[model samples]
Target: MPDPFDPSPDSGDRFTFGLWTVGNPGADPFGPRTRPRIPPTEIVAGLAKAGAWGVNLHDNDLVPFDASPTERDLLVKEFQQALADHGLVVPMATTNLFSHPVFRDGAFTASDAAVRAFAVRKAMKGIELGVELGASTVVFWGGREGVETDAARDCRDGLGWYRECLDFLCGWVKDQGWDLKFALEAKPNEPRGDIYLATTGHMLHFIETLEHPEMCGVNPEVAHENMPGLSMVHAVGQAMEAGKLFHIDLNAQRIGRYDQDLRFGSEDLKGAFFLVRMLEGTCGHPAYDGPRHFDAHAYRTEDVDGVWDFAAGCMRSYKILVARAAAFDADPEVQEILEHNHADPDGIGPILAGFNASNLAALEELVLDPDSLATRGHRYERLDQLAMEHLMGARS
Candidate 1:
């Protein structure tokens, strides 16, 4: 439904995108990167002109690993200047621990003591960078913090190591007096057969075990959750309800497949629409007010222009879905359906309250009363049709 040929309109502060989203060569393990590497400063300029108020990145994405102290300082200074010139800000920053060879075993869960310590240091450094960049959230995506086989390591030790890592990070933040929060990201399986914090539920529970639970939250990515065919809206709602939805990544993926990181609304429009509604909806009172970063990639077949189009499309599609959701709310028929039959049965409250036998009788009567039951009319097919019409822009 996207018009790739349309002019790229400014999204204002409605969205933010990751620095890594641009110029992806679409490489795999066996293939090499084909897209030209654009400098991080240039990338910031492009995103600013594209109308993003903020950008997210991994530390190494903007700052090279092999740079000397002076070189790193120069790089950071240039990046800071670029931000000032373009009026852009940093929403989040993360450590790229998995890409380095030292983390072949894992980052936080590495069995080797030196490797584990180095991973911790790298993460601390990444947090410092985020603080310097005025970022609100620091993300930890443990892509390499898992084992290919159970026999390769002990699960207890791995969990303990992960706990130690998070506790240290939390303590480090307090020591530095930074105002940033940590957003822990999760994926079921990827570089490893099973990731340590494998889902939003698991991540939330683990966050409670941290030294500063108040400073820890989850950064749920749509594609990561959808990889296992999870209801993206349900996963996001869980994080939002807990008031721990620190950040979000918007992307698309095929069911039960690799982390494709497909363009937004490329695979699932209904799912995408519902997600936008839940995030931007007033009825539910969305708990998150952070940037919607498009952590997706361009297809291998596309060129540089296609990459820009992909970026524009990400913002445009999300804005369109948000508008459609607003329209859905304004529609009188939709509101009528919601008021009449979208919620739990009205008789349920009385049935669940008092334990008296008379109350039980009343509950039974409510169920047996054909007239009351018949009044609960759910026009699901029509409701779905209404949403579809909006999605297609065919209200007529």
Candidate 2:
């Protein structure tokens, strides 16, 4: 890796991984686990050795589903020991609410009161782990928070239930008085036919209805945004502009498809280019200082070694794009185009003052003639070609 502190740099200690990514074993709805189930500590150790700065995890990733309280303590103890030995930390934690069969109907919007209560308790446990591990935030991806058919329940009720659950969780965080925050991961669909709060804008708007809206934000996932055929860069840009980009999930997906969870930069390098440029301040925004957490999983075709490669590749692709972004900014043509579009501080000073009725009326005939003024169009194709060339280091 190039030294990040150097005058010219490529990478830095800004990469984090989800423990589930390295341990997924390439499982899917149609398939079983292909690789052996590795222990939690080993996963953390492997990620550390593979160059991950830290990790985030779903609650069940480290502890067994039915782990006793004593067992939970032992597991957290071992996990913390591994972290101390490897110099790693947990930046975020999430509850695995969509996996269990009980959540088939939904967690927060379950028809069964008992099931809904159970989901809430499970989330509280997730928060407990986050607090114990000193996580900066807890993420909630409502994978099954909606229904398959319109006959099942009103979507309004689902949204209301979601807000209610969030209100409780946010209040719980405050009552605990820990310096932790919560993020809502918006997925268009997958485990369920439709997911409530299925986009960045939906969740951001929903937060306003909550009593503790200030405690919640969105952790927009790239693949999720791409699944709905939305502009991934624009979605992230909106989150950052709203100060609700509490965390991020970096991954790849083909346009208008299932959630592939492919490795970052696998399918859309250009989209990743603009996304990284946004985070790196190549656009006129402040650079994001939060964790670049990879919430992606390995392909079902991959083996154990492939899993590690996918994990490392997330950071590698991000660094390469950062370099490309710097190159894009320093290019003279790009600077010229940006400057041409920029509103100069001096304003159209004397020009606006000269737009009096007399001269304006005298020039009406010439101004009204379409052929009199030549069109000055934006050379967007040229700019796009420039970006592509720089992305591939082909600026010869």
Give the top-scoring candidate (lDDT).
Answer: 2
lDDT (10s digit) by residue, model 1, range 69-152: 788889989999999998888979998989999998898999997999999999988888888998879999999999988897
User: Candidate 2 at 372: error in angstroms?
Assistant: 8.2
Worst 10 residues of 1 by lDDT: 4-13
Alpha-carbon lDDT of model 2: 0.84
Query: Stretches of candidate 2 above 4 Å error?
Result: 1-11, 344-374
lDDT for every model? Answer: 0.83, 0.84
Model 2 Cα shift for residue 115 (angstroms): 1.9
Write model 2 residue lDDT over 83-151, tens digit each, in one string: 999888898999999888989999999877788889999999998998889898899999999878968
